[model samples]
Target: MLSETNKKILSLAVPAAFSNLFDMIQVIVDMIMLGRVSPVAIAAAGISMQFLGLLYAFMASFSVGNSAVVSRFVGAKELDEASKTTFTSSVIAFLISIPFTIFGVFFSKYVFIFMGSSEEVVKAGETYLSIISLTFPVIFIEFALYSSLNASGDTKTPLKIVVVANVINTVLAYTLIFGKFGFPALGIKGAAIATAISYYISFVLYLYVFLTKKSIVSFYPLFVKDYAKRVLGIGIPAGVERVITYFSFLLFVKMIAEYGTYTLAGYQVGLRIEGLAFMPGFGFTIAAMTLVGQSIGAKNYEEAQKLGWQTAKIASVFMGFMGVLMFLFPQYFAMIFTNDEKVIQEAILYLKVVGLTQVPLAIGFVLSGALRGAGSTKLTLLINTASLWFFRIIPAYVLSKMFGNVLYIYYAMFVETFLKAGILYYMFKKGYWKRQVKWKT
Candidate 1:
């Protein structure tokens, strides 16, 4: 029989995993629907989707900070404090997301310019970016509440909520994109609208859970003054980590762009398909972070370490299997993305290179997730941010400028994944996060 701890972890992991699957179903469906529209549209949506991933990264970071602290409090049986923690985090995320919402909606054209896409790419991406950014507040609030609830051991609620939301998003995106269900065919913008509607629906469902549940946490305006600063303190580092890491990918895209539209388009196809393996790793990472925080909060450092290692092993095993499939059959998968032979060939090479790196990539996610769970976001911030600029982005810019080829561009991704995994494992095994943070709460 499995131990209770193992069983507990799976209870959260299974739902967390499904939520991620639901999230990916939308992406997979989008590629199918939009691929029929035009290769240009597919490429545009693909590149634009990378930028949109920043939204999730930011949400993950905040959720990391929030879940660690909230779970710690809950594990200590401080239910009221835990409730207050979540409510405060949600408010803070809401406030911060508003300006981003405005900028994302109104200034998306500028964002695309920074991304170095062509005129056609810019026009398609800007439309998608603007529409998705409109839902920033909804995204932030839903993420904050859901992460808190999951940490509080209500994992099933968020899973159910996401299932309902993602189904709506997929059906609506398809229907609106194809002029089904009495809807106009709005193309990429229709996908955005579908996503935005789903997020709002998820938020409404989360609100219901927050209000009517067995939660010890509640919204008290005074707690914001008390807990909000700590939340941001932990969050800002995680946020910086994301901003820096993805910026490296942006540089890679820029380098790929110099090779011509087809090359850039190929990289986009490979990337969107590659996202499937990544989602599961992310789910396991979330589980590791939550488990570590709760264990350490209960003064069980050994359990914390065990949780991290086990989750790492699981993620590595899963990603390793995925890496093999991608490595062995890159071209077969490439066909799903595009029929252009040149695009297919370039995509095949890129996929083969990146596929070998997936297990290490999984290790990196696990390490970072473990660090965040221990409330050591500052260390993660410094390491991940510095790596993005120093190791990943700078190298790509140099190689791409001098060599100017797909191989040179993708090398940076390969190197960065290896470096981060090595560094993350070192820091994780160092076990410094076991020290109790003595800040007055």
Candidate 2:
């Protein structure tokens, strides 16, 4: 039987996992609406949406570090330190978003061009990126508040807010993108607008949690320049790790783009569904990070390791069950996103491929999250970047060359997940991460 702490972790992980599933549903809904226009429209939206994820990649840098610090403080029962870290994290997130926001607004088109998308996709993407970029600071700040709150064991608030926001996004995406509700049909651009508005709504909800709720981390007045570096010390490497991984994935997308529109659309849809499996893993990952960071802060390395493995076990069980559903119901699931037979067939192929990798993916995410909570971003950087490029990206291209099958290409990704999980598990067991970070926060 799970203990009280295990149950507490689930209370956090379940909400977070459900939150990710909602996001995946949101993506499917977006594609279902967009797919009616044309396959090109769907692919264009998917590619641009992905390009925006690059921006999210940057946001994660500050947020990840902030969460690590915040979680540790909470674990240590250091309320003042946690609150101070929250304020510092907000300021740091704002500072980091400035240049990216500017570039996204001014050169949205050129950036898409650089990403090597088609002329049509680039033009459509510029609209999506420009509008979405406007919400970067809002999104990051919202992320900061949510991470801080969740670390304090308040996952329900973020989940509730995100669900409400996604519902707004859903209705607006339908009305604005499809010319319903007497709104101008803005197509992909309309979807971006809806998303931005949702982020604003979420920001308001986060503001409430911090303001109204009695949490360990409350926003404070004193702003310190030194705090930014302290936040970035852990954040920068974590961010760099993500950037490398994103760039590699971006390259993988570019390679797949060369194949055709159907392939890209199928891959895009399948990817979102696949995220559902890993997202449950991600929920536990968040728990692992929070528990480990806080445990270490309390000077309880023994508790940290115990929390880490417990989280991993829960994640594995959940993901394994989800994998069964994914493998068993591929066609039924594919239909939720698109009706195009060809697209559905391709998506089903990727879904089944994902099933085989779900357990490994769970381990990789949960263990890595635990390691990051230990403030060992450099190790994560090396493990993720190396396996991503070596096992997945390179082999994906080579396999596509050999067989011309996207299934074979995804098989390479499966291999990469196992490799990452294996290596990370070993490092985590050895206890090197416990000493790597000297963070005072």
Best by lDDT: 2
Off by over 4 Å in 2: 35-44, 115-124, 178-189, 255-266, 338-345, 399-408, 437-441
lDDT of 2: 0.81
Question: Could you tell me which 10 consecutive residues in candidate 1 have the lowest summed lDDT?
Answer: 214-223
Q: Local error of candidate 1 at 33, Å?
A: 3.7
Model 1 C-alpha lDDT per residue in residues 98-169, reported as the tens digit of each score: 888998888887766776778887888788878878788988888888788777767677778888988888
Model 1, runs deviating above 4 Å = 1-6, 34-51, 104-109, 112-134, 181-192, 214-222, 399-405, 439-441
Candidate 1 has a TM-score of 0.87
RMSD in Å for all candidates: 3.2, 2.8
What TM-score does structure 2 among the candidates reach? Answer: 0.90
Assess every candidate by TM-score: 0.87, 0.90
